[model samples]
Target: MKSFEYLRPETLDEALAALSDPDAASLGGGTNLLDLMKLGVAGPERIVDLARLPGLDRIETLPDGMTRVGALVRNSDLAADPGFAAAFPMVAEALLSGASAQLRNAATVGGNLMQATRCAYFQDPFAACNRRAAGSGCDALGGANRGHAVLGWSPACIAVHPSDFCVPLAALGAEAEIAGPSGTRLVPLAEFHLLPGEEPHRATALEPGEIVLALRLPAAAAGFAGNARYLKLRERTSYAFAVVSAAAALRIEDGTVAAARLALGGVAARPWRCSEAEEALAGKPATAESFAAAASIALSNAAPSGANGYKIVLAERLLARTMAAAAAGTPAEMPALPGSLMDDTGEAAHA
Candidate 1:
């Protein structure tokens, strides 16, 4: 591992001060940072550990019926939290479908939100990746890119976002609480993550020294009574990355879909919300036909790679299955696909 300085600050101000340095980086749970460091992908001169920062680990229900989830909240804890499971089952279910229990214990909410993409070109050192080196041509354009992206992709990058949590967060309309030199601010979860249009290296909107403080959900999102489901299609049943996954929360009133929130993962550079699909389902009866139509609307403009040409069909089927299960209050069987391993090590470093 590369040598670096470490500072464990007990206060947010100290942590921000350390992170303000050009050579310094912030550490939340170390799940992503440490992995990148070991892979020679991230070499920072200093690290500002936010573990000791106070008021960043509290999970409380606001008086307005919104939930304030601390940045330091463990993924396992958040998944198993009674309040989260009840009020936002989609969030809890999404967390449960990610890495195993042991890894979840070590992962934090903030780190998960800040986690990078899983593109092989971005992780492998020998590959020429535009995301790794701004001017380098993206090798994935002609390389093994079955799991890259199908939506919101530019010539600069086709890397797929890998956070399972964000899929649900996007569908649930969650907001973020951030702190920086400018003081505390709130960012909509949908807008928090940026797509790789021209700058593939710039992943998020977090400015320098800005740290995630908490995740806040809107009060209107609660009480959706209908079934909420998270469908993950991977190469394996456990410990695998999603090839195409869908998180859906459907609210059926009098046998008709009153509202729905659908978000897709492993298909775009960022968590993708299917507003067209949502619009198609609104005010319509929840049925196999409607679900298929919605899924079709969602994948209408999907652009897949050479090898991943099947992803479009797979995504549609998975989405259809998710909506069908949500309508029936049953869980869909996870589909078996190739090369969907939990190991994201093949991705290249800065090209």
Candidate 2:
């Protein structure tokens, strides 16, 4: 086991200062970081604990109707917020769909954003994982590649990011408040995460020592409110990671879709929203046939890895369902594929 220095700074500035160490990593909730540390996947020389830092645990709503979520706020609290759920049901459902209740209670918003990929090869240091160790090559590309990415994947790495919240955030056009060495900056949530190309090690656009202060969810524009849903397809019913998930919001006036937002998870290196899909839905009827057509257009460019071609079909089906459910104010239905796609274990069936 590797040894490391643990620093618990009381103030935000102190915590940010401690994170300036080149080999340091920030710890919030430690649900994800501690596990990686135990597995030797994360070997930080210093851990800057941000759990006790002040001014980052509140969920405040402003006069402009925008909501500011502190990075340290627990997932459970965020999901349980009455105003948040009423205004952004899709985002609330996305948060609730992640992990078990116990784990969600302990995990922070920022920690979830920084959670590493759950690729089998990335978890095992002995395996050839380009994300874990640069230039090591990726074993998932040709072996046990069923759970790998179907979109935004490169030859260097096929791992998909694991985040349910990111899907809704991306679709909602949220922004992140980053505190860095120079000063503070607000970055759109869509641009916060990076797609793994040759540099899979760099999971996020977060610069070294740049601390995430908060996540700001802008108020939905007029006519774009309430009609939204988050649908996650896992190997099992609950408490499992998504094999495919969709976050969808639509404004249907006179039975026609005025505007739409659709973002996908578990299919790409980062949560992805297709402009083509949104465009296809615009000025179209909000019917099942229309939804299916838009979904097909959304994944028109999808290039699935071997064994994961099922994801393309599955994503389209789920996308259509999510759109219908959101329009009806109902939750999405589950497991649209054959029984062979998922078993009792809620894990990918590896060969």
Candidate 3:
């Protein structure tokens, strides 16, 4: 095991100051970060613990009906909150679909949003992973890639961001508030994540030493909460990472679609907001045919990898079915793919 200095900060300023060191990293629930450290994929010189920091645990309501979610709020607590569920059931569904009840209790929203990818190559220090070391080749390119991304992936890196909460958050047009060494700033939640473009190592748009304060859910989106659903397709039926997931929120009036918001997970480096699909569903009848058409259009631009071409069609199926269910204001639907695709626990079977 490696050794390092640990600093437990009591204030946000102290936390920010500790992060000014080039090799310092923030410690939240430590569920993901600690695992990476133990695997030798990450070894920070110093760990700045923000567990005692005040103001990051509140789930307060703003005057405009928009909710302010503190970065440190526990996943289980937020998911079980009736008021929070009433306001954003889709987001709650996304949260509940993550890791496990035990992990969720320890995981913070901010920590989850910053989780490293579960790509096997990225997790294996011996493998050539672009995300682990830029300029190093990405082994997943032609290696075992059954669960790799199909969209927004570059030749440099095919790894995807592994946050379930962020998919619906992007569709709802949420905003992330951050505090840094200089001052506070806001970034659109949808754009906060980065694509695996030129710099595959840079995962998020957050500059060094910038800490997330809270996430703001827009007040105007309250109406869409009633008919929203999150569907995750994993190898297992339980806590495994998504093979393909869809977050669908439909606003139907009379017999026609008034508005629609669809975002995809497990398909790209960031949560993929389907603007074209939303536009296609906007005045169409709330039916499966309409959903399928829009879903196909959403995946039209995807370039699937050699071993993952099936994901292009799989994504379309998940998105289309999810949209039809959302339009009917149905309850959450669990993904039921063939059992052979995943092992007994429900994660993808490594070929």
Candidate lDDT (C-alpha), each: 0.81, 0.82, 0.83
- lDDT tens per residue, model 3, 1-351: 367899999998899999999899898899999999999999999999888899899899889887899999999999888888877877888888888889999999888778898999999999999889989999999999988889999999898778889998998888889889999988888888889898889988789998788889888776787577777788778778888888888889987889998999999889899999999899998777788899999999998864898989999988887776566563443223211122112111110
Q: Sort all candidates by lDDT, best to worst.
A: 3, 2, 1
The TM-score obtained by model 1 is 0.92
- The C-alpha TM-scores of every prediction are 0.92, 0.92, 0.93
Q: Candidate 2 overall Cα lDDT vs. reference?
A: 0.82
Q: Highest TM-score: which candidate?
A: 3
Model 3 misplaced regions, further than 4 Å: 330-351
- The digit string of per-residue lDDT tens for model 2 on 115-197 reads 99899889987899888899999899889978788888999899888999989888878888899888899988877888878
The 10-residue segment of model 1 with minimum total lDDT is 342-351
Point out the worst 10-residue segment of candidate 2 by lDDT: 342-351
Q: Candidate 2 at 31: error in angstroms?
A: 0.8
Worst 10 residues of 3 by lDDT: 342-351
Local lDDT at 61 for model 2:
80
How well is each residue in 65-145 modelled by candidate 1, as lDDT tens digits?
888999999999997787677777767777877887888998999999888887878887678877777878799997898
